[model samples]
Target: MARKKTITKLQILNAAYEVVRTEGFGGFTARNIAKKMKCSTQPIYLEFKNMDDLKNELFEKIKNYLKQEVYSNEHTGDALLDACINYIQFADKEKVLFRALYIENHLGIEKMHKISLDFAMRLMEENEDTKNLSKEDKFELFTKIWIVAQGIASLISSGLLPMNEEDIESNLRDALSDMILGARYSK
Candidate 1:
């Protein structure tokens, strides 16, 4: 008798990640994941209670992946600015994932906003430029910079803009400077 092959939850999650990474949320189904893993859908069902459970886990995995692989590694010395650049670079590099999570709203707009706001607040606490600002000012600064970053990221991911690293950095820096100046003087 042949031995049975057992699939683990981690394996299913990884396959699901590949599915989402390639086909976006539209293809994020157990059947697609099973096909990607070269396994039967039975294994996926055995590993996960339902697609929603798997999807929730997958979103967490993606968040950690972004934090570890994309955001944390930026070396610009400016936490918030580095985050903006990282967001843009991630959009350029992971076009499918970027469109799925951000543009197509698979990550949920409110959740994305909360995540961005929390990350911006944390980064602002560490940034010399915005750290001392009032919470309202910090939010204003973050909102301005994030709008610019999102515009650039959206255009780049959609293939309408082909910008180099220098231009990206320059634009983000200019936006950051302008926002910071505006926040300071608007009082």
Candidate 2:
């Protein structure tokens, strides 16, 4: 009979996620995860076909983390702007992981862009002002806000700028207002 597994697949994935969280994808390896898990790499290979499979799982976990944890910040009336702040805060906090996912392109640009777009759409749906916007306008305004947020995130994550909450709020508020007004005029 086949032996029952000891280390769970989730445990392995979690270990890998932690590694990537602290060290980025460059440190992703069986040996690294094994060190983190305090176990042999055998369980890792047994659970996943290869590093790519493990990475794919990690990516999904990251997505869920973003939705359920990062974006679930305390509501402050302006849910859309709060969501942008949450995203930038996440980047500031998880610099290595953010750099890996966004800057290093280790997670693939297309997937990240789609995920960001989807998250923005969900936030828009929750906002009273944006909830009724047409798809084109929503996409246009969201794209603009996302661009600004991403720039701020990238700068903060890369240490180009300090993680100043006031600065983030100011930049995002100005951009959000300008984008909304521009959309109104163009409409």
Candidate 3:
């Protein structure tokens, strides 16, 4: 008799991610994950206490993946603009996953928004031009940028816009400039 293969936690989590990537959170299920892994649901249950446990772990992994890949962009002299472009590019590339994460709120929109805000603040600190801004100002700028970036990302992800990189950068710059002006006036 052939021995059954042992599925590791990482293997199960990876398979789950693949399921979410292709089928979105709507399709995230132990059966689907097992199918992706070409295994039975027993392996998934063995690796995770339940679907919720697997889902939480997969959410963490997805966040890390987004931070390292989607949100992490090579600096183009302007760190904020680079981040915006990278975000839009991520939507373009991972349309379904992006929709799941941001559009469908499968991973909890509030948590994702907090993660995005934190990342934006980190980028703000890295930029010499805006590094000295007060915390409140930093937040204002981040919020403005996030609103615009998310809007563009949604449009691109939903097939509503065929946004070119240059156009995205231009829009980001405009939004940044407007936000700076508004912040200065309001202060």
lDDT by candidate, in order shown: 0.86, 0.87, 0.85
Expressed as tens digits, the lDDT of each residue in 11-125 for candidate 3 is 9888889989989998898878888888789988877899989888988998898788877777466777887888889888999898998999988999888888888899888
lDDT of each residue in 1-187, candidate 1, tens digit only = 9656688899999999998899999999888999998878998887789999998898889877877787766657787888888989999999999999888998787766777788889988887777889998998887888789999999998999999989999888888988898887788
Misplaced by over 4 Å in model 1 are 1-5
Residue-level lDDT of model 2, residues 72-105, one tens digit each, is 7864667788888998999988888888888899
Candidate 2 residue pairs that clash: none
TM-score of 1: 0.93
Measured with C-alpha atoms, the lDDT of residue 155 in candidate 1 is 98
TM-score, prediction 2: 0.93
Where's the lowest-lDDT run of ten residues in candidate 3? 178-187
Q: What's the TM-score of every candidate structure?
A: 0.93, 0.93, 0.92
Better of 1 and 3 by lDDT: 1
